[model samples]
Target: MSAVLISVAELQELLDTAGSRVRLLDVRWLLGDPDGPQHYLDGHIPGAVFVDLETELADPPSAAKGRHPLPDLAHLQKCARSWGVSDGDTVVAYDANGGMAAARAWWLLRWGGVADVRILDGGLPAWEKAGGKIVSGEEPDPEPGTVVLTPGHMPTVDADGAGGWQGLLLDARAGERYRGEVEPIDPRAGHIPGAVSAPTAENLTDTGHFKPIEELRARFAGLGSGPVAVYCGSGVTAAHQIAALATVGIDATLYPGSWSQWSNDPKRPAATGTEPA
Candidate 1:
């Protein structure tokens, strides 16, 4: 079976036979929030290892880049080796925030040419709600598989590239952020020129669970795209948009640096007080 997505029940059934080959990752982190690892240390799914989003998944912040830049491929390969993730292993990842962080792992794994990856549906909360097993302790070790890194999967475009590309650039921030009306995280208020606003929050209901697949299809269909490229302040929330699009068979790519990096360079054009062009 293709490594798409698996529910708690489906994972439970698979755990009996493929437990050793299945590498479970708990990717939980929050922007400007320091309590993520502490929460993970308190409790997590049994046999799951914690993957820090900022340190493990992304490169350090730079002057001309976003807060959560994409990590170096060589560094990530080492991390995969440490986690016992060989090229042949089936990796599963989950996060507390409805696959936001987990999607990062999924994207990174795919970018590294590891196709046998799946995100746990509904994340940790759903796992706990389903009465799945939990354990608190140091992460266990697995036999490392061959680590193979690939390129060209990281689909990113600069301001000029975005303007010239045929794909629709979907901004996944709140309307206020996208409009450059409010400045909460980044110093700049505007977004990239010609980018459409498609907030990730719209993908979820009031309860924070993902909306139905049909609803997601309707939402993405409204974008009218040749190809879809999703972005956010620092590429985190944008993953939510990608996940939503994937549910609807949209298969959108992510602009990893996103608005944070775009706004850093004064030369790049930024649009304020305007809708997408």
Candidate 2:
């Protein structure tokens, strides 16, 4: 019952009692395997709709904007309605890749002004393990939603803002990437200067559910006391970091351009190695 996460049992209750008001989004995506729609077609929650992170969730990429810039607000509104979301609907997003990808939908919907959005804790694996029903093939799209959306509901920072940020800037990429051990898809390796490495994978337990609240609190203790901003390779898993911080009662801003945009700009200095120098 975390503010940003919903348990499988809680989702089941809502489905049983408030079915008409619940909007389920299956946001299945993985870094190398991004064929989300086809994977969703193979199996999904009974009423969940698929959200494509590449197309629906993000704008087309460019050097200045990073790999997954926030979708334009108007486009996001259109997409939300297509998912059958209404102003007051309870939106739940889940993915097979822990909550890594689904958290993007959760963050976007909230930023677009949908209140009460939650990530299904442990995602699909949790659902099935709890004996929750699963169905294959696309469910008929729900009636087009009437949800009205506004941008900037959640905090965000652009490259310049991230560069000058005085708060704790958390780099939510893998430690190896943060250390510049691999370049992968970006123009360079290494993390934003002065940002701390807090990989999103550590947020989960072996069972894939988020760890207990106290444990999370202890994990982040003393990282910083000021405002927090987070970023990952392309701003996707960063949402997962924000979600984890949320469960720990920390409000964080998202750096949408993240490392992708930062690395591409030759003007921006890339700092490698362990120290956040």
Model 1 Cα RMSD, 1 decimal = 1.9
Candidate 1, residue 117: lDDT: 82
lDDT tens readout by residue for model 1, 1-277: 1245677888888788888888888898777777878878889998888888888889999757688888998989888877778777788988888787788888888778886888887788889998998878676566665778776564666656655558688889888988889978776888887788888878876645678878888878887778888889888888778867876777777887887888777777778765785
Q: Model 2: how far is 29 from its true place, Å? A: 0.6
Poorest lDDT segment (10 consecutive residues) of candidate 2:
216-225
Give me the runs in candidate 1 sitting further than 4 Å from their true place.
1-3
Q: What is each predicted model's overall lDDT from 0 to 1?
A: 0.80, 0.91
Please provide, for model 2 over 60-83, each residue's C-alpha lDDT reduced to its tens digit, 9 standing for 90 to 100: 999989999999988989989999
Q: Candidate 2: where are CA atoms >4 Å away?
A: none
lDDT of 1 at 143: 66
**C-alpha lDDT of residue 113 in model 2:** 83
Q: How does model 1 fare in lDDT?
A: 0.80
